[model samples]
Each structure stands twice: as C-alpha cells, then as structure tokens.
Target chain A: MLRHAIALLSGGLFGSGLFISGMTDTAKVQGWLDVFGDWDPTLAFVMGGAMIPMALAWWMRSKRVTALTGEPLPPAPSKEIDTKLIVGSVLFGIGWGLAGLCPGPSIAALSYGGPGLYVFVAAMVTGMAIAPFVRARLDRAVPAE
Target chain B: MPIDWIWGLIGGLLIGTGGAVYLLGNGKIMGASGIIGGLVDGSGLNTKWERILFLLGVAVMPVVLYPLYRDVDTHITDNYWVLIAAGLLVGIGTRIANGCTSGHGVCGMSRLSVRGIVATCCYILAGGLGVILFRHILGVI
Candidate 1:
C-alpha cells in the first residue's frame, strides 16, 4: 500500500512537471525541435534542470540495496549500442517532430487534447499492441542475444 | 508567452524530483515510454496493476491541474492521418528501441547510461533532420 502511494505521488509529480514545463503543449515541443526555423530553447532547460536531481538520485542509490519501499532496484543498465536502438530512435524522432507529443506528454494531454491527439494515441497504442508479436516472430527466426 | 526558460527549468527540476522520488522510494525508473511500452509489449504483465495505477496517477495530474494548462493549446496537427502516422511511429520506435525522452533522454542521461545517451542523440538528430525535411523542404509541418 505504501509503495503504491509512492508510485502515485511520483507519477503525479511527473505529470505535473510535464504540464508545468509546458511539455504537454505540442507546439512547445516542436518549437524546441525546430532548430533551424525559429527555435525555442525552453525545452532544453527542462532537460537540463531535470538532470540535476536525477543524477543525485543515481549517486545516492549506489549505496543502497533496496528502495524506501524495500523493493529491489532496477537492473543494471545495458551497455550495448546496437542497430535496433538507433533505427528505432530515428523513427521515434520523426514521429515526435511531426506530432510534438512523446509518450509522457501524450498521456497527460489526453484531458484537453482534441480529436487529433486522440487519434495519435490510439494509433500509438495499436502500434504498441503489435510490437510483441513482431518481437516474438523475430526471436523465432533468429535467436536473440 | 514565448520563451519561458525559467519555467522550463523549474518544471524540469520538478520532473527530475518526481523521477527521483520514484527511483529512491519505489525502486523504479520513472520512464514514461518504458512503463507504458512494457505493458503493451507483454514485458510488464507481472506488474500490470502497478502500471495501471501509475498511469492513472499520471493521467490525473492534468485533470487536477487543469487550471494551469487551461489556456494551453496542445497544438496537435490538424491532419488526422498525419497524427496517426506520428503516433504509430512513436509507439513502434520507442518499444523497439526501449526508451523515449523521459526514459533515455532525461533519466538515462542522468545516470550516464551509454544506451540512454545514444538513443537520445539518435532521436534528437532524427527529429532535427525530420523538421528540416518535412517543415523546410516539403512545407508540411
């Protein structure tokens, strides 16, 4: 119960931060991405400011075995820099630039976002729904490492 | 109304703190794409209820704080097909790659994770090039 509450608080804080920073605004995101055409640097600050506390958290967690909730920490980070990551990132960037809504903001913006946002999320979820099948099929064809 | 860098910084800090809270207290990564992506891709099946509750918590923030963003226009493109295409790409790409801005860009970079940095770079570069292509060359922003 306590862990769940913490999760809720964390998630809520995240959502509020996204909203307060104007991340939920689609134009703000595209404006930041538009480096060549009237660039907006506000979003950059958002990332910069966010990094400070997060870095500290990582440093602190290195000393601990479990979280405040007694749950184990996440697994070690992956060191591999493979092709799938790059290709997928490239694909995601195109979509982000096109629509200006990444997953975090997309979910939060569902409240007041118009029909366009609705369609985008629906399509995104649909895409997600099929990803496992694709991965499974790929695994069967070629044993993953 | 244009360059609110200070607010961005403030919000980013809050965002980071939120992530920190989740990480330190819940022992979880506050990665939006990873959290939601895992659910759709079968990776988070063992923790579905937690995921659902986390998402509900996220979704409710906007509703509760609607007053702040009441005037904000999300600026979603007017084109429905375009929206669909964008959404599909975000979904498939993030799942296949395993991260997004929050996952790899923010939290990932904070930890100095090579995967996070690389993924973030790829998407940022791609998004920039994409803007140049669609918005500049094709005039289809």
Candidate 2:
C-alpha cells in the first residue's frame, strides 16, 4: 500500500513538474535542440537543477541496500556500451529533435486536446509494441547482444 | 535568462524530488518509457497495477493542474507524417536503449552509471545533428 501510494505521489509530482517547467512546450524543447538556430539554454538549467537532488538521492542509495521502506532497491544498471545502446540513443535523439516531445511529456500533455497529439502517441506506442520483434531479428543477425 | 528558466529550475527540483521519493519508497527508477513500455511488451505484468497507477498519476496530475497552468502549450507540429515518424523512432529507440531522458539522463546519470552517461551523450549529440539535418538542411521538421 505504501509503495503504491509513493508511486502515485511521485508520478504526480513528475507530471506536475514537467508542466510547471515548460518541458511539455514543444517549441521550447525544439529551440533548445536548435543549436544552429536561435538556441534556448533553458533546458540546460532544467537538466542541471534536476540532477542536483537526484545526485543526492544516489548518494543516499549507495549507503543502503533496501529502500527506506524495506523494499529491495532496483538492480544495478548494466555497464555495457554496445552497438544497441549507440544505435538506440541516436534514433531516439533524432526523433526527439524532430518532435520535441518525449515519452513523459507526450503522455503528460495529452489533456491539451489535439488530434496530432493522439496521432504521435499512438504511433509511438505502436513502435514500442513492435520493438521486441525487431530486436529479436537484430539479435539473430548480430548474435552478440 | 528568461523567466522560463526559473520555472524550468523549479520544476526540475520537483521532478528530482519525485524521483527521489520513488527511489526511496518503491525502490525503482522512475522511468516513464520503461514503465509504460514494460506494460505494452507484457514483461511487467507482475507490477501491472503499479505501472498503471503510476501512469495514471502522471496523466491525471497535469489535468488537475491544467487550470493553473493554462498557458502551457506543447506547440507540436501539425504534420501527421512527421509526428508518426518521430513517434515511431522515439518508441523503438527508447525501448532498445532500455531508457529515456528520465531513466538514463536523470536517474542513471545521477548514479554515475557509465552506460547512462554514454547513452546521454549519444542522444544529445544525435539530437543536435538531427535538428541540423532535418530543420536546417531538409527543412522538414
């Protein structure tokens, strides 16, 4: 019960922050990505500000195995920097540059009520649904994760 | 800096605090893509309710706050083709990478994970390149 409650609160906070910070603003996100065009550095400040508290959280995490609530912490992240990581990141970046809306903002902004929003989200979800099959094929070809 | 920067910072702090709460309470990374992606892929049925509730919270909170932030507009392109293409790429890429801005950029990097750092660098550079190519050269986006 506590865990579920925490998730709700955290998720709500995350969504609220995205709106308050203007991250859901596609124009601002695109402007930040537009380095050659008139660049907006606001995202940098946002990213930096977000990292500060997260960094502290990580420090707290390092000192404990389980969460303060006694649940096991998430498994440690993998260290591999393989082809999949590079390829995926690049693809994601391209899409992000093009659209300026990521998974969080995409979902969070749904209330804005636009046909294009649904179209983009539907397409994104479709891509996710097909990814496993694509990965399977790629793995068969590469044979080495 | 514009007033937007201040709001960005304030909002960022709230986001970080949200992440912190999740980590300390649920003991999981608050990754938007991974949470929803796991559900769609059927790999996260064990935590189906958790994911749903989290997503619900994420989806509903903005609506609750909408009246207060009525000026918050996305300004996304109306081009259906572009939206489709970009959406597809984002979905596939984040899943394949196993993270997105939240997972890799915020949580993972804070933990000093090498994979997270590398992925962040790759995506940022690629995003910049993409902007140049699509917006400047091709004038598509």
Candidate 3:
C-alpha cells in the first residue's frame, strides 16, 4: 500500500510539474529543440536544474548502505556502448524533433483531452507491445541486455 | 525562442524533489517509463484501482492548471502526420533503450546507474543530431 501510494504521489507531482512548466504544450518543446532556428535554450536550463538534486542523490547513494526500501540497492548495471544503443538514440531523437513530444510530455499532455495525446499514447503502447518480439529476435542473434 | 525559465526551474525542482522523496521514503525510482510499462503489462493489477486513479490524476491535473495560463499559444510547426510518426519512433526507442529521458536521464542518473549515464548521453547526441538534420540539413523548418 505504501509503495503504491508513493508511486502515485511521485507520478502526480511529476505530472503536475510538467503541466505547470508548459511542457505538455508541444510547441514549447519544439522551440527548445529548434537550435538553429529560433532555438529555445530554456529546456536545457530545465534539465540542468533537474539534474542538480539527481546528482546529489547519486552521490549520497554511493555512500549509503541500503536504499529507501531497506533492501540492498542493485549495483548499477554497466554495459559497453553498442550498435543497438546508437540506433535507438537516433530513432528517439528523430521522433522527438518531429513531434515535439516525448514520453514524459505526452503522458502529461493526456490532461488536455485532445486527439493528439490519444494518438501518441496509442502509438507508444503499440511500440512497447512490439518490443518483446523485437528483443526476442535480437536475442537469437546477439543476446541483448 | 524565448522560454519561461522560471517555470522550467519549478518543473525541475518538483521532479527532483518528488523523485528524491519517493526514493528515500519508498525505495523506488520514479521513472515514467517503468510506471507506464507496468500499467500495460498488468504488473500493478493487484492495485488496479489505485493505478487507474493515479492515471486519472495525471490526465486531469493539466486541465485543472490550464486556467492560469490559458492565454498562451501552444501551436507547433509540424503537422499531425509528423507528430504521429515522431510518437511511434519515440515509443520504439524507449522500449529498445529500456527507458526514456525521464527514466534514464532523471531517475536512473540520480541512482548513478552506468547504463543511465550512457543512455542519457545517447539521448542528447541523438536529439542534437535530429535537430541538425531536420532544421539545418533538410531545411524542414
């Protein structure tokens, strides 16, 4: 019960933040991504500000014993840069630039009750649904992590 | 081109603080990717009602807040098809990469996961390249 509550509250706060920041509005995001043409560097500042606490948390966790769950934190998984990572990154970038909405903003945008959110969410779910199949096929060839 | 940095700062603070609270109090990483993925996979079926309620909250908060800044124009340059294609691609990328920007860049990086660091870096590079390709190279702007 507690865990579930925490998850809900955390997500709610996150969503609220996105809403307050106008990130749910796709145009704002596109402005940020349009570096060469009317670039909005505001998103960078947003990201940077967000990174501050996250950085502190990482530093503190490194010195701690157990996580908030009282269980031993999993050792950070380390992996080499591979083709899959590169290809995946490229795909993500292209989509973000084209649509001006990523998972975070799209999920937050659901509040507007618009067709665009519905379409984006549907496609996101479809992509997730297909992931297992793609991973399985890749596994047969090169055992992805 | 001009952004409201004040709002961005506020958003970042909320995400960071909220994420930390969840971690310290609940021992969980607040990754949107994992939460949404779990929703679809039925991993949270035991608490289905709560999940639905949570999702409802997420979907309604913007409406509640929209009244304050209703005057702002939220138009985009791209058409519906472009946005749709972008959505499809992001979906696949997040799945393939095992996370999204919030998942990896914010939550995972906070945990100092090496994977998170690498993933975030890739995200930035890809985003940069995409902007260059679309706006400059292709003159799609």
Of candidates 2 and 1, the better by lDDT? 2
lDDT of 2 at B96: 87
**lDDT, ranked from best to worst:** 2, 1, 3
Clashing pairs in 2: none
Model 1 stretches astray by more than 4 angstroms: A136-145
lDDT by residue for model 1 (B1-141), tens: 655887799889988998999899989988888889878878888877677777887789988888755457787789888888899989988887888999898889999999999999999898888888888998887
lDDT of 1 at A127: 77
- Which window of 10 residues has the lowest lDDT sum in candidate 2 chain A? A136-145
Q: Write down the lDDT that model 2 would get.
A: 0.87
Regions of model 3 farther than 4 Å from truth: A59-74, B1-3, B41-54, B70-78, B135-141
Query: Which of the two candidates, 1 or 3, achieves a greater DockQ against the reference?
Result: 1
- Order the candidate numbers by TM-score, best to worst: 2, 1, 3
In terms of TM-score, how similar is model 3 to the real structure? 0.84
Candidate with top TM-score is: 2
List candidate 2 segments past 4 Å from native: none
Clashing pairs in 3: none
Per-chain TM-score of candidate 2, chain B: 0.96
